[model samples]
Target: MDDTSNQEAYDRIARIAQEVFDMPVVLITFMDGHRQWFKSHLGTDRRENTPDQSFCRVPIATGKTTVVENALGDDRFCGLNDVVDGPGLRFYAGAPLMTHDGFAVGTLCLFDIKQRSFAPEQVRMLEDLAALVMIQVKSDRDIGRVDPLTRLPNRIQFLLSLQDMVRADPGRTCWIVLVDVIDNRNANDVIGALGIDFYNEQVRHAATILKRHLPGNTVYHVGGAYLAFMLDGAQDTPHALIEQLDTDLREPLVTSRGIPSALNPCFGIRSAGLMEMSSPDVLRTVLSAAREARLSERLFATYNSDHDDAQKRMYSLLSDLPEALRSQKQLYLVYQPRIDVASRRCIAAEALLRWNHPIWGPVSPAELFPLVDKTGLIHEVTDWVMRNVLRQIAAWKAAGIDLTVSFNISSKNLFEDDLVSRLSEVLDATGVDPKRLEIEVVEDMNLDNSHIAFSRLSAIRDLGITVAIDDFGSGYSNLAYLLSLPATTLKIDRSLVAQALTDHNAAVTVPTVIKLGHDLGYHMVAEGVELPETFEQLRQWGCDEVQGYLFGRPMEPKAFESWLAASNKALLASA
Candidate 1:
């Protein structure tokens, strides 16, 4: 986001806040990039401060207003900057500048040079002023910010409404029901044949059904195919809502040009008695529970505290990952070599991302993938992996290794318009042959927009980059999808690799796939070949490449170089 526009808007807000508080310091502070930076300020020239000294961070981080009437007497503020040093700020009161998604981006704060206390009315006024700042900031993200098509509150408006809902009087109970609408695969196929307008019509009908299940002026088209309603004074228990919506949605809804079709709308319900809560606190919590119920018959889940903690932790991980990548030690790459079975040579290597969190120790990609996918952090992570992997390949060339490298591309990245251009530029800048870089795309995820994916892959292939379908047999195990793309390699999924050696079905299945790949002009690569028997079986099956722990475990860059040297020396000595 360009902060210039937000900053220009913040100037007016900061002036209003400064006038309202009649204090020496009134500032709009944004807590982002792991530090608090002032967006606009009066009575102080300082632009940014460490998190500890960021008075606004207290409110931003907690999503609660903070007041320190006498800063010097408070242990939390006594020794902090602006307390004992320059400006000598002694009083503080801040209201969290919350975004619609419920994240406290910063705080709208006033600090006096002398000790001061806020009356009840003054405090309420301060909160109202802070809310006004939020409204202006949200308006910057959209013009009036409501959906024209749905004629309902969009995600941003929903967020603003959520803040009000959670902050209402304690006796006014409120519930946030997120109805996630998904079309059945075949039903989607039918819709596709009918056209996009048909799908939109179905969603609109499903939304009406969702609105019927909830009460009073609360329905919102918060996200794609999802309707959200803030319910209060519920005459019925929240669980009852899931029953009726699920029952009504089982049959297909009427579309523009097709017969009525099923638009499965799942429900995730969360309620809070008037108490201070943040947007991420409520929305993400309910989402975690909803995901568990997505494939179930009930298709609805109420928020659980236990479930919420994990979601919170995941949020922290996503927030911290960018900083972790920038640090020296936390995020690094490891290479697992893919070997040619016939030649017994290291033919290629796959660059795997490894995050060694100081507390979590080792976080697996399996756990990391979904966390990032949901949080929309996957694209940046994919970019990091690609740039680093390509750079590593170039470095290897300089060191006389000249290794071919393949790195997994996140499913989310396939949709990026610049995906092809970014890869081409990286490869070109690194001076690495495009063929030496293979992009391992998860084939199943590409099914959603095969034409788009295929188009991007074609553009990528035009740059001489090989496209490999990673985990080919795991999802739906659909082999027909391969015929549509220009894939140079098919990674037989680890699960299939586990059984291919011993299981009769897999033994037949594995060789058949290898031949099919060969006939289709793709190199068949078996992933996760941890045993000699498995390696030998795969070699016998004419697997062109085998990548697994049996060859070499993923190692640090320098360690990989050392291991490669040692292995080549051993081969020469044996010869």
Candidate 2:
């Protein structure tokens, strides 16, 4: 009713009724809760009035044509404000705009200041007009209900239909299944490489496959690249349908340009009694499950409340992180001392990010970084960490403390075009030596783009800044590729260190990696060296540096300065 087209249609109908009935005022009104909202008023300037002040309410309430020859003579309407006040309407006639379900949602009515008799033929004509109004209303609604591209019912219609089903049989059990045809990253890649037309073709192809597989089921384009449908829990199982759909989707979809693209669909399913959940809640639950499927690399996943709650918390944390970065107290860095194996002296430290969320208490980097890595905000977060770390280094340098600091950067950040320039600007601004700071690039980066990564790292290294291959021996660590990288150090992953003494393969692999890193003319650092035996083993392997709780856990800047002083004093005393 708020749509301009709907308003225009109602206005045209109201004008026709006023001219045909020879009435002074004509209105198309709908009863909305406690108020009567006028969709169209030909003679009156008022937009809405209370139901008690409306003549249309009578026909809507009765679900039939209502006629009052004289409002002043009728006990039912004589005391009404519109009747007793100025412009005193005496003749009133209304025909209920009843839906197909036999409920009157509104009314088309005529009013006159002068008392007049309404003939039976004139009453019939008003009812006919009311029917026409209903038809137009439904036509507009149906148009809104469909997806323009696929010609299928969209999320709006799906929610409406689901609500209707729940109302009809609250106890009925059903399964809501959602399929993500392709993830956002892949969808963007396809659209960027090919074009929107090809992407639309892919969506249409997926819709066609879904319709063919499900046959009688109605598949809805609930979201971008997402298709959803519901199944009766008693009559059908989504497993078989999901399997068939998955198999079909695996086959490449050929576009008009004959380029073949795979859908790579994942499914999320939630089964519950309709009475147990609202329509929107059910859809949201299934969507969370779909995201879980994609994250876990599964073909399908069932809804889990625990995972859903955790995901919600993650999103809340992500939302709060930008503000937290700006605040002085919420976000801070802690330094874990890196000890040189030969001198057993504190030489450098790694700057680790920490967040003390006001609401969530403390957020771990493990939990926060994975989510941040998936977004563009990773760049902002990386820049924040770099700037803070550089400032801390400047403070330490000014205080006559000779210490180097390193910070981790995401794989995405390593390939950033302006990474070198950004670092150079921050370094110059802080008056910190480039050699005093190190950039840690994780080894698990996509090697397929190794050439770009190599060039970016080389550019950074040309600035006289040290680059270290972090989390070595974990992820895709190609020795040949590792040799080609412009990195000066290799930090062994904690997993291998944690399992080295206990696992046979790790025991052999640990020393081999340390020796290989040294042979490549790279400094070797072992992380997670908790046990004294582990530290001794790495020291014997000629590892250049070691960082773990065995030395000191990550500490604030002041605490790190104190710890470094105490360690230096101890070294002098021991000497």
| Highest-TM-score candidate | 2
TM for every model, in the order presented, reads 0.63, 0.81
Give candidate 2's error at residue 276 in angstroms.
Answer: 3.6
lDDT of 2 by residue, 410-510 (tens): 88986689988999999999999999999998876474457877888888899889999899888677786566888999999999999988999999998
Q: Counting only residues 3 or more apart in sequence or on different chains, how many pairs clash (N, Cα, C under 3 Å) in candidate 2?
A: 0
TM-score of 2: 0.81
Q: How high is the CA lDDT of each candidate model?
A: 0.78, 0.87
